[model samples]
Target: MARYVVIGGGIVGLATAHRILLDRPDAEVTVLEKEPRLAAHQTGRNSGVIHAGVYYRPGSLKARLCAAGSRSMVEFCAENDIPVRVCGKLIVATEEDELPRLRALHERAVANGLPVRLVSPAEASEHEPALRCVEALHVASTGIVDFTQVSRALAGRAEQAGARIRLWARVTGIVTRGGEQVVRTTAGEVVADVLVNCAGLHADRVARLAGVTPSASIVPFRGEYYELRPERRDLVRGLIYPVPDPRFPFLGVHLTRMIDGGVHAGPNAVLALAREGYSWGRVDPRAVVELVGHPGLWRLARRHLRYGLTEVRRSLSRRRFARSLARLVPELTERDLLPAPAGVRAQAVTADGALVDDFLVVAGPRQVHVLNAPSPAATSSLEIARHVVSRLPTDRSPG
Candidate 1:
C-alpha cells in the first residue's frame, strides 16, 4: 500500500485524504494539522457562502470547479444530513457606473453556464424587498451553510474510512531519504510515498519546505464584517452583493442572510498584519517585514493604493462601512450594524504584482501543493480534492 501524508486539516486537506482513500482504500493515509482541531483558520472563519460560478473568469479553474462543486457540495451535504440551503444571491448595481460591470458579469455568468439572469430593480426588490439597485444579477445556485460543520463531517467520514488525522502536528522540516519523504513535525516524524500540501495561509512556505518554488507568495488580507441587528435582519432576504470592482479580486460589501437566520454585511478587504490576523490588534512583526520585502506587495499597493486606502478607512469607521452597505439597502444604517468575527484570506501575489485570480496548484516530485485557494475554495473543496487526487501516480506498488 502506498503511504500518503497530507498537510493541513482544513476542508481541503481532509477532503483530499478522503478522496485518496475512496480511490485507494488499502492506501495508508494520514493528515497533519497544526491546530488542536480541524478548520481552525480560513475554513472556519469564512462567510459560509457556497458561491456559484458567476464572478470568476469563464475558462478558469474557479469557474469550472465552482460550477461543478456547487452541485456536488449540495449533494454531499444532503447525503451527510448537513443543514444547507440554496438561498440564492443578488449582485446589485446601485449606481449608473456599476451597470456596465453588472452587464459584463451577467455575460460571464452565462458563459460559465450558470443559471443567472440580469434583473431590473423591481425584480431584485421582489427577491430582497429592501434592496435599491439599478440592475442586478440573480444567481439561483448560490447557497449558505456552516462550513465548520462540513469540515467536521469530512473529518468524521475520513476517519471512518481508515484515515488517521493527527492534530497539533505542525510540520517543521521535510527531507527525502531512500526515495521516500521524511516529514518532521512537532509531534513526531512521518514517512510517506506522497506528500500533499493544503496548508492554506501558509501553503507557500510549506511548498518551499518541500523544495517547490511557488510562483507567488501568500499575502494575508483581512475581510472585516458586521452583523445586522436582530430586528434589522428582516431587511435582507438572502444574499445581496454589490457588483465587484474588476480591478481587484474582492467582492464589495453587501448583505447575506446566513442559514442561522442572522444577517451579515460589510466584509471590506484590507492588508492583514499576520498570516492569521483576523483583527488589527493581532500584528506580527515578521509577517509585516515579509510583506514589506515582497516586491509583489509593493507593486500591488501601487496599483491599488486608492482602493486599499478606501478599504482601510472603511475598516476604521463604522459609519463609512454602514454607508457602503447602504448603497444596496438604503434602509440600513450604523445603528443596524454590529461587529462580527472577521476572516483573513491568503491571497497569492506574484512577484510582478499580479493577483492570482484562479486556483493555483503546483506539482513537485511526489508532492502536490495548493499555493492559492481563496474565496470559492470552500465552495470548490470537493472538486479540488478530486482534481488533486487524480494527479497522483496510479501505481499501487509500495515505494
Candidate 2:
C-alpha cells in the first residue's frame, strides 16, 4: 500500500515520484512503468533539445515551467553527474517573408523573460558557418542532452529515497475502492491513496481507466527525422530552427544537433495512424478510424490543409523534404542526409480541432493527474515533478 502510485515511467512521472520523496523522505511512492525500462516512449525518442523557454506564451505554464525547469534540469544534471550541454540554438529567418515572424518570436521571447539576442547574418554565420540565414536569434539557454540518462537518474534518486518502481507493470485499469485506487497491471495490482496519471502516449486512456473524465483525446503525431550525411554533418553546429508559423501548432522542421554528435533534421509532423506508430507502414485501424471520425481532426484538416498536404508530400518524398531543408541551409541536398529514427507526440486535442495550447491537469479528491504535457515537458520535467508533489495529499499510509 503505497501512499502514491505514479502511472507512467516517463520523465514527468519519475520526476513527480522523485519530488515526493525529496519533499517527504518517509513518503512511500510506487512508479509503474509498462515498458521493461524507462524513457522508452517520448522520453527516449526525442530530438534531445533542451528548450530555452522561448516561443511559449508569456505568463503561461509553459513559460514559467520551461524557464525554471531549464535551469533546474541543468542543475539536476550537474548534481547527479548526468551529461548535458548548453550548446545553444539559432532560430533563423531563411525566407525574406519570414523576417516578421522571427521578429515576433524575438518579441515573444522577451515577453517570456528569455535571454535571447538578435544575431546578424555574419554573427550567426560565425556560430554556424554552414548555416544560411538572413538573420537569426541566438538563444543561449537552449542545449542538448540524453533525456534517458536524466530519467534514469531521477528514477535512481527516487528509489534511493525509499520510493519503489515496478518495471513491466503495464497498468491496464484503475479500480477505485472506498477512497483508494487499486492500479491493475499485467503483473498484479498496487493500491494507493493517490494515483498520478503521467502516462505519456496512453494518458487519456489511463485517466479513463482511473475513472476520470477525459476532456480530450490523445492524437499521435509522428515526427520523422533525418541524419546529416556523415560528410556534411558539420553543417549544423547546434539547434537551427526556422521561423515558426504562428498559425501552425508545431515549429517547422529544423535541424538539431544530437548529444551523440550527428545533426537530426526535419521532424516533420504527421498524423500517426497508431498510438505508437513510428513508421508509415505501421497502422491501427481503430486508431485511424477514431482520428478520422473526430470533428477536431476534420477542422484541423481544413485549417492546415495546404501545410498538411505538403507535409504528406514531403513525408513520402525525400527530395521534397530536402528542399524544405534547403530554405535554411542552401548547401543541403537530398544526398546530404539519411533517414533517422522517429518520435511520436501524444498531442491532446479538443473536439473542435484546436490544439491544447497550455499544460492541462485535472484533479481528484485524492489524486492529481497530468493530462497533457507537450514539448517543454522533457525540459521541464523536474519543475513539473516539484509542482505535482506540492499538490499531493500528505496524510496517508506508506506502502
lDDT per residue, candidate 1, 253-305, as tens digits?
Answer: 87888879988896899999999999999999999998999999999999889
Residue pairs of candidate 2 with colliding backbone atoms: 1-399, 296-353
Instruction: Mark the regions of model 1 whose C-alpha exceeds 4 Å error after superposition.
Output: 396-399
Among all candidates shown, the one with the greatest lDDT: 1
C-alpha lDDT (0 to 100) for residue 157 of candidate 2: 88
Candidate 1, residue 170: CA error in Å? 0.8
TM-scores for the candidates? 0.98, 0.97
Q: What tens digits encode model 2's per-residue C-alpha lDDT throughout 1-399? A: 338899999999999999888887777799999989999999998888899988888988888999999999999899998888998899999878888989999999999888899999999999889888889999999989999999999999888888889999998778888878898899898988888889988898888887887788888999998899878988888889999888766898899988888889978999999988999999999898879888888888898899888888989999999999988888999999899899999889889888887788787677787988979899999988877777777676322
> Which portions of model 2 miss their true places by more than 4 Å?
397-399
Q: After superposition, how far is residue 59 of candidate 1 from its true place, in Å?
A: 1.7
Q: Deviation in angstroms for 20 in model 2?
A: 0.9
